[model samples]
Each structure stands twice: as structure tokens, then as C-alpha cells.
Target: MSSTSKPSSSENIVAQKFDRCLADLIVKSGVGFSAGVIASVILFRRRAWPVALGTGFGAGMAYADCDRSFNPARIPGTRIIPASELKKDGSS
Candidate 1:
């Protein structure tokens, strides 16, 4: 059997998923942080910290909603199997 035919380890799959999730989170956080900076620096010169915090919270909520909208399995109480596994089962 060739090495390419071997199934990937679960640890590798998990690590990949973790990396993807972290990357998504960082991008989302940056967008939120930028919005916060804009609002604090431009609109509300005083109380910048509070405004930034509030906007950041709003951004986080938006991110959660957006994430759920994109991936239905992200909702609570649901099992999320990767598409590759489904394909392996001939279900796709």
C-alpha cells in the first residue's frame, strides 16, 4: 500500500481544524478591533475605552451569528462531521 492511501491521524485533523478556527477568530477579531478604533478615534473622542469595548462586544456577537449562519452544525447540540468523512462513507 502506498503512503498516500493511508488515512490521516485524528490528531492531524484536529490540529488542522484548530488552526482554521484560530485563523478565522483572529481575522474576525481584527475586523472588530479596527471598527472599535475607528469609532473611538473618530466619533467619540472622550470615553474611548467604553466605546471601543461596546463595539468590540457587538462585533463578537456579529461574528458568532455569522459563524452559525455559515456552518449549521455550529449550533448547540449538533454533531459536526467533516465533509471528507461523509464522502468516505459514500454519503455525499
Candidate 2:
């Protein structure tokens, strides 16, 4: 038996997404860490927990965004619609 099927586009590795993901991870985590440092100095008496918490939150957010980019269906309040549903006049 032989099957001729085109490879799925989703399987393709996109360089742009990787670059964006890396940038987001760096920027967001850095921002979170900075914010935590400020908060620690101003309110938390320079404790370490705040910094760690902030970094974790930033990383989690980045992970969510990356996941959504890789699989759009994982995004909240989003759904996948088949091409048939997009037709205006009920024609394929």
C-alpha cells in the first residue's frame, strides 16, 4: 500500500516564532525581575521571595504565549472553524 499525502504545515518549524519566543522570554522575565527588585526594595524589605515569584509569573506568562503561538487552539476564547463555515453563499 502506498499513500501520497502532503506534509502538514503545522509541522513546519518557523524561525520567526522561535526568535519571537526567545525575545519575549528575555524581555518579560527581565521586566518582571526588575519590577520585583523595586517592589522588594520599597515594600518587601529586600526579600528574595518577591523576585522569585515575579520571575515565575513572567516565565509562566511567556510559556502561555509561546504555547498559543505554537498551537492557536490553546488560546482562551478562541475556536477553530472549518473552511465550510467561512463560505458566504454556502459553496465550497
Pairs in steric clash, model 2: none
Candidate 1 RMSD to the real structure: 7.3
User: Model 1: clashing residue pairs?
Assistant: none
Per-model lDDT: 0.71, 0.85
In the range 1-92, model 2's lDDT, one tens digit per residue, is 35986754643556678788989999889988998899999999999989998888888888889988988998789988888787954773
Q: Judged by TM-score, which candidate is best?
A: 2
Model 2 Cα shift for residue 48 (angstroms):
0.3
lDDT score for residue 9 of model 1? 100
Q: Write the per-residue lDDT of candidate 1 for residues 1-92, one digit (tens) a residue.
A: 66577677988866776676666667766776777787777877854684558556755776686667557788999997889898999964
Candidate 1, residue 15: how far the Cα is off, in Å? 0.2
